[model samples]
Target: MEDLILKHVSLEHPANQQSHETEGLSSKHLVVRRGEPFRVTLFFQGRLFNPDRDSLVFRAQLGGLLVKFPATFSKPQSYSQWNAEIEPGKSVRSQSVTVTILAPAFSPIGLYELCLHILTQPRQYSYRIGEFVLLYNPWCPADSVYLQTEDLREEYVKSDVGFLYMGTSKNVIPRPWEFGQYEEGILEICLDLLKISPQHRRNWQKDYLCRSDPVYLSRVVCAMINCEDDRGILKGNWSGVFKNGVSPSEWSGSADILKLWAESKFSPVHYGQCWVFAAVMCTVMRVLGIPCRVVTNFNSAHDTNANLVIEEYYDGMGKKLHMSKDSIWNFHVWVECWMARRDLGSGFDGWQVLDPTPQERSGGIFCCGPSPVKGIRDRHLNLIYDVPFVYAEVNADVHTVIVQNGQVLSRSVDKERVGSVICTKSVGSALPQNVTSAYKNTKAVMPSNRSTDGSPRSRRSYANREEKHTLALSMSLDKTPIAGETISFTVTVTNKENSPKILKEHINAQAKEYNSSPLETFWEVHNLLRLAPYEVKTTVHHITHSEYDEMLLGDGLMNLAVVMQDTGSYERVLVTEEFNITNPLISISMTGNDYVVKNEKREARFLFRNPFHIPMSGVLTVMGAGLLHKKVHSNVSLQPGEIMEEKISFTPKAAGTKMLHANLVFKNRPMVIRGFTTVLVRAT
Candidate 1:
């Protein structure tokens, strides 16, 4: 272990200091003499195991001030590789790092500190070794580069010398990018681009072509504002865009504009991910002199369910596919661009969909065909329903045309019927591409549960969308504690509409259902019962433990937060609660003078000689307050009827009354018990 500490960190003076306003902390001072270059250095003092053999690494941060400051670390800079190494028992005296700060011509510099951090490798024994920050001052600069790129090819290779993933080979190729082509049918709700000139529109139309084309970046941008495909339909992947736009002035802002643009087109959903949209937007923005970046997610909005769609044009069964695995599926992409204002802040940031489109409707008229019509009112032929096939191919002579009501002279003519149209029409042009199912009978296969690895009994991943009966629910906590001292909640569901059947499964609801079902989808659907319109039905549920919940309580404070968001629309509702274990006030009476500590590391001892009020069982949370350790066992079933003798050890860092908060949950009632006891440690 190294005894490292921050020796010197400060913001040098005379720049410009805002007076101290808040308590204790003073106002920023020493504004970098406007336009003058300043130097900031952080000194580190520590006892390292070995200075000669051990590697020293450091990173300097200016705390997010937009300046032309060039920062250098005493230790080499390598992003994905380890930077420092110390011998097991050697020692080092001290080290220092320097950074040059150049204030922008338009910037108003003030007092600001620099933070430094030391890194350590993880090991079996939990070790929190060192954390320290060093402050430093920054002055103005004559003319400094805002962002600097380092030639780190050698460092990158040396530190990252290993067999890389196969997919990394794609980096060797430099291909001309295509932009904006995916936005053919995207629509942005908040934007009004109706008056954009036609010439600009034509330019934007060809923007998504090869970047090597001779078109100027500005011309392409003019075209981007006008390229709109009205017929394209996609899933509501870009739903969050309407609410915000991008801010280009801030470094860490969000990509709201890009989100709008991306969501406007269904391309994000059409491709099963937004990669095309994000890529095109980023490329277009870069060409337009706007800095941009791309973000990718393994599981994106397109395939929220595991039932992911991979793009592939069918070319017989056994042969290799044309598209590569990387381009097919498994990857989703989005773009972040410099904007004037982020949706949430003024930081130059925003996101938009490269391919925007309207949300596709699920339930629509899937079949439609032309109907044969005879003389008006002669005999209404039921060709639409009875002979739906006849409409697929209509005969010219069989079809009739009549004159309009206001015609001076009545006339009738025979029009040529179009060729056989074996067409299957849905309500929207942008319906989701249906994939061939691996199993024919979903009901039969659903019952034969199996894991993704083909295990005998596996949990099922549900991807249903029905479950919207009453459009309302009531929640109540069960009096009976199901597990531990926790209560269960019962939600009563009801439906209002009578025409449509209530789907038992929960479906993902669209934020807006201009074309499909109105109800939103949920991950799990339970205790569903059919009820008449305006009737009410209830469901009882117990909160199950999730890995995240366990992680929350693992810390000192147990924080619980629930976010109910409209996934289709991206609307959110949040509920939060916190439980703090501060002071356990109850008193604990021990039978013996000196208690023996056991393997459990608790100080409590229970002898089989005494018969307690009753045997209790639920959950067990063994903890040592001063020792900073806690263990929670869920759904614990304790057998107290047999003779039991146990000694628990409690080691406290400080001599005080440590509290133990105990809770018992039962079917009929739940009880909470709190107790505390003093711990004495022998003097060494």
Candidate 2:
């Protein structure tokens, strides 16, 4: 009998050999979907023997269990030929055998040890080839929810959502032009997700996606995006400790962030606020074949306790005090994944909330939801996965109290502010979709239980307008002012009183974050004006860049407040207005299609006309994450009324949504002209 020798081993997908090469398949481990055919080619040599005298048999085992398969003798072709050529001798006498096996549709999702055995007359030779991982196929008939054909298009497959980071300090509401584009890096994220241990993958496959229990998958994904666990990919940072000078809002897509995180070997991702976290989560879900959209809630409340009330304290001078555990963000973003909730049964299907932002902890981990939108809308606080917390975000009432030396001077209730204007990107479009009605009732339903003081129950409304008070106040800007230009606004205060009274007016303008407290006073005016009964006065305040530059916070959003006190009655009325200091505009136009494959070169042109009388000379800086290298061109000169054009070429390093920014600064003035464009990088 000839000694049995295993000469060459290879795997082949007979259907499409070239496509498998691009897929980066490995011989040690083969990935296939359930109900798919797995084929492999093996070459072996033996001494010459009569066909009838010697017989060879093959067998396979997974987890030490016998897996029956069919084998046949055939010539090596496709990928197998490449393996055969790499061997020492091309003329070696050997028999090429092909094995075809079918993974059953009901096969568990995991890595299975595949063993090939060659049986002869006296003994059997066994070779441990590799592992076979069977994954859940959403396209298969066994899947509960099937994605429609249209969903495979680039719009749904690759989408973008706007995030309004109005800043935490001021209310100057800038346009919601900042968008998080998702795509490109999805494949890498998906591959990382599949690297989970075999047992964990098997459990998720069986207990989650396979059973149509998307809530579990949603929860897992929320935890995996942030570095709260060892399994998470991106370490989140909200403190703005980025190595680059880029702000958290400069990130335009999830792909670049994930790519940077991966390139950094799983280090903390820089400057990710709430919107960044939610947008990236949307990309991961969509890439894994789960339908998802990013949702933004204006005036979103973070109720530390379960009570649906947010208590805010203010001093006698109208300065806000952080005395309560509850707080309301100017805007908070989260993702809504579309899946059938097999765990919750009927009405809970459709959109479910999944917030990846590391806010409050849930079940000892910093992840929230798969909280059903239906549960929140129906006020089912008892449901699982932080439904009550989410409900408070949209339905809670805000109580603003003015206190002095721990004494309550006055209290005001705002029922319409919290959880206003919940929106998402429309399907197949970039327009905003009003999803507020989906989270709450159309008609206001007062809570059956009232506070001990017999006040109206706290309820949320989708209306845009605020209710008017007895003392009407209005504000307007003189003109839309750009950065470095003077900003001026007029505040008109009216008193609706029957008799003449002495009024102490306090008019203050301060730089603030979009959703938080006031930072520094940009301009202030205080005076005691004696007015006739039902008198109205308008005051105009002007702020120069020299006066506000150092005090201006992120994005230069400012809050203007007018407070009037009736000295005799100690009654105070307050009104506020928010506006943004515009930045100098530089037109940025792309020369080619904004969407391109990874490593493909694209070009953009930046044009800016010199507004100054003198010749302006400075450096033009171009930057982007994963999209372009930081490039700076010095000695950029522009004459008065001359349009300076600079073209930049970039090759995207990763797939996904990306942003390109150009900043030009003049040596003469403290003026910066900036422009940016969003691009979609697809992975081929």
Candidate 3:
């Protein structure tokens, strides 16, 4: 038995196909899901090995903790403990051995080193095979992050492409986002995110040990997604100017951002908004084996202090005042991860909110949740995590206050404006599945669950319009406004009384941002009109393209209002409507009904039409994972009503569902148009 030496080891053989490591299956590292067995074969040299007398021990090490188990030549029935064993008959006087290593469902996740010890007569030997990575397995029933629903696991864990619902609730825009968890180098970056955390820096061993718990792992991921602490991944930027880095709107996927973060030595990426941050968090959570989905709350309120109210102060001329501390966004995005809450007892084990946006600090850190959705719905404000903050975002009351010269003129409270629509992308589809009912009861019952008296607040309204009128006043757009075209809207007024009346119509338009208050008035019209007794009249107003285009910056948006004052009675009515110019679309079509296979070339054509009479010029960038290794840029110019066509060629790198995205950034204007085509890559 002097020549009983191990010759070769096999990990990439066909035996590993059942590991369910789609992304990492083709990776160089030994990638696998927890609670499942992965096989590694060993070949011996010279003479047949005698397993009856010789002994072998397999050990796996993470940080400072080491686990060792002797080879039993039999499979362990329970996945509660890590075990390694050789096949019984293969070890019987044979020169080859097949070993199975089963990691428990509760093992700490990260990179681990595996070693083997061979004990024989008069000598002992040890071999360092290689390193492997362990990720969460939703398919594993014994795992803490298990999801029995196959569709949910497919949508959350396996699906690499998804959408983030943006725009207002009335006109929700489904923005495509590439989660890219299975993309090359992305899983490693997600793993490195945990390694660079403050918890890991303080005590590496304790951090690794706690990773066995999904709750702890998710909280760390939330805090690490924002740069407010730990110099994390994204530095959020809400302001329109993104001179130093890429604007949050320009990022179509997370892999590019993750790669940039890693290539920059783990420094914070230049900028990220709510959706961008949430998308990155989803990628990390899903790649780590936690089921997650991106959610959008239209008319989402931001209560500065725990008060359940968002106040809106408007001046006498219908100008929104910036006096209040609280503000409401047109929409707010966050991620909901599915995990069992063993800490919160039973009944609270469904979807939990985990916001990575740097809005407020929780536990002196910039992370939000693992706050159970049921807790928010049932008004369980006393639970762990930041439930009060999330509850206020969706359920806060809007108190519209007309403040002029430090005096209150008129006040109205709107209960349905905040969180009128809350939803996420549906499973296996691009349509939105409304989850608002899951968050709040449809009865419109107001809960006084939040504490009061912290500070004065404010809220903005866009979804529903409230009207209180002496002589009825209403304003609405003729159609959805588009860039480089005349915007037309009609104002309707009626003398409700039985007598004739004289009125003054004050039509004002001010530039506004999506998140903050409106700026100075860009356009206004004052007209005196006479109405017959109990008569209804409608007037159409138009803002020329050049007139509104001069004030357009960052985003093509404006808050328009018409204040009607009765010259006879001194009573006034205000009607306001906020609208944005929709960007043109870049339409893409493939060559034919052909299958996109990995490592094969495909051709696509992108077409764009310039609706504006004026000439348009911009740079078109085309990119996709598994298709294009890097972004391809081409300068494009189009005349008025010109339809331009461009062709692109790409070769996929791996087999999976992928998307090819094209973005056209207009020169000297803050306008952009996007288009994408889905590619189902088959194995070549």
Candidate 4:
């Protein structure tokens, strides 16, 4: 009895003889883009085999079916040919034999397995050599949809870093997170994602990439990441009502979420918010060779009724009334994918919005746009997909009405607040790029053909008329406030009349749900003030975290408004401000080690203090892209004035600058304290 073994294998270009070896084949996955030419060389040896009398057959299988190759077995080149060793008594022996595999340009994108069968006498021996993955070529003429600018290529196509901008427009802050799409585990998850089709099987056509379009593929991704129909991938719970007690923002990367989803086939991934959904979708898109960038819209409007207006009503006592179906989120995150809209034709090819947040439905499914950005800017609401819905997200008028006993007391309109800065991560950097102008009109320009009237004044004229008749009311708040702290703001009212006047002042603050209506009222204050002619009065109000927690709605984002009315003239004015009550920034120190080598395990200790007076209990999650896999310690309780310490053991799998994130969420409280540190991982 003798054994047959594969010595080595290599892929080479026939003309240039440029080769890639398959020595540690399983460890290294071969990659090639569509329309590329390459030849595979297989070297094998057998103990009792005669090369002159035995024949070998090579076969390539894709999606469990044999794929046809154009050519195989070129004339043996000197460097790869088999040399026979003439033995004294051994029957004609060959040390090694080489075979060449020629793949055509039309070979589709997929994992192709190569197998070799040796035939001698009545027995045939078979072995699986290796597998190669074919990807879509962005540089190819037929794949021009993936072609992007250098900046876009760096930010969306190549880089796995993402930025989530929270807070208002005046104080926009960026939170950096990593996506591990290039990781082997994440790549496997993405490949599996393509196969789990709930409603449709359009992700891969005939198990071939060339047969499908990018537009449809992107839509499928948006639907899959949300786990809308199928078990899906990410479970979304914006209300923080998760069975695991961990908020969506606690998770660090898409890889961990996908890994959890893969491990627990019965249970979907724990949690994901808008940014998480968008970030994970970016990973999936980029892994599939589609250019994608996560976008954050400040003061994003969610018009549930398809109307280009977000309306809010209030009572005379300054209590916010939930009368309208529309609402505005302090910030919302979505992804913009670059692709050619062959389905929609010319003038619509570019970055298309694809939101996987699962807020509303589009075309009966939970997937959102392929809606063209140009159409949104030009007010082409008649276009396909959810153009009207997205148009209002970036350019919508906010109208606030004060009513008492079903009578409209006063109404004011704000045209500049609904959607503020539309931002994305800058190319090759972590900074934000203001792409507001790309989504809507930045300069003073004529209204699009879809406008109610041809003139821009129609939008601003109503607001100006209300301002002239009502007293000047302005509301200002301290720069971004943190939870577990007192937030103070002043409301100033000016009486411009010549005669003395009596005014009624109403101040209201209420918690609001993301993309939904306002929730329970947190705090409210009503007062009567008398002002002399041309007199200005300023009143300050303070709110504590305990008071905010009492009426905390979804995520602790609040809508504060001040309504003032002139009792003498019966004129009214309203001023509103939107702010996010973020968790107090606790000091987090990472010690024990500053760096680690790739594939080496290291332990790091982290100390984070609880700034709140009351004891807190929640989950502490530590995660990183290539540095540390997700390690979470649940039911971590911290006493007042106590510093909680956690030790994390992680193995660095990839080299370069890696980020380690620690998120602490207090159960039943709308506070989520987060801290991160960058570590250098050298290649092993």
Pick the lDDT winner: 3
lDDT of 2: 0.60
Give the range of the ten consecutive residues with the poorest summed lDDT in model 2.
Answer: 79-88
**Model 2 regions lying over 4 Å from their true place:** 1-145, 152-213, 229-231, 234-247, 263-265, 443-470, 476-482, 514-516, 520-522, 578-586, 590-603, 608-644, 650-684
Lowest summed lDDT across 10 adjacent residues in model 3 is found at 455-464
Q: Model 3, stretches more than 4 Å misplaced?
A: 443-472, 494-500, 529-534, 553-555, 567-569, 594-600, 652-656, 681-684
> What value does the lDDT take at residue 261 in candidate 4?
81
Backbone clash count, each prediction separately? 81, 11, 1, 1
**What lDDT score goes with residue 517 in model 3?**
73
| lDDT value for model 1 | 0.26
The sequence of per-residue lDDT tens digits that candidate 1 reaches over residues 1-684 is: 644444664444423222111111122222232233344444556643223433333332232321212233333243222122221211233365433433323322122343333433321111122221111111111211111222221111101010000000111101112232112221121111211323324553332222211112222232332233321212233221222322111111112233444556422122211333334344334322233444322212221121222222111111112332312111223332222221123321222112212111111221111111121012223422112222111211211111123231111122211111111111122111111011011111111122355532211111012222124433333332212233244444444545323424221101111111112222233222455666666555444423112221111122222222232332222222222222112233444555323222445643321112245444333333343244322343334343333344454443322333222222111222222233343322
Residue-wise C-alpha lDDT for candidate 2, range 304-403, written one tens digit per residue: 8878899876565645556887877767788888666667767887678988888788887788898889989999888888898899989899776767
TM-score of each predicted structure versus truth: 0.19, 0.70, 0.92, 0.80
Winner on lDDT (1 vs 3): 3
Q: Report the lDDT tens digits of candidate 4 across residue range 243-320.
A: 773467565667767778888862568788898899889988877667888898888988877778888887876677
lDDT of 3 by residue, 1-684 (tens): 365788877875444645564544237577777888888887888778788667888889987888998877666766688898787775688988878888898999888898888888778889987878887888888887889888999899888888898766655667788888766788788888999999899899899999999999999999999988896999998788798898887888898899999999999998999999999999999888899999999889999978899987777677776878898887789999988889999988979999999999989999999899999999999988899999999999988766568987566677887898898999887788889988898753221112254321112222124445457766766666778789888788878888888988778888776676778877888899999999999899999888888687555667787777788876666656666677777898878557887887888999999887688898999878678878899999999899889999888887877788888988866777888877888997
Ten-residue region with minimum lDDT total, candidate 1: 160-169
Error of 4 at 428 (Å): 3.3
Judge candidate 3 against the unseen true structure and give its global Cα lDDT, from 0 to 1: 0.82
2 against 4, candidate with superior lDDT: 4
Q: Which is superior by lDDT, 1 or 2?
A: 2
Candidate numbers sorted by TM-score from highest down: 3, 4, 2, 1
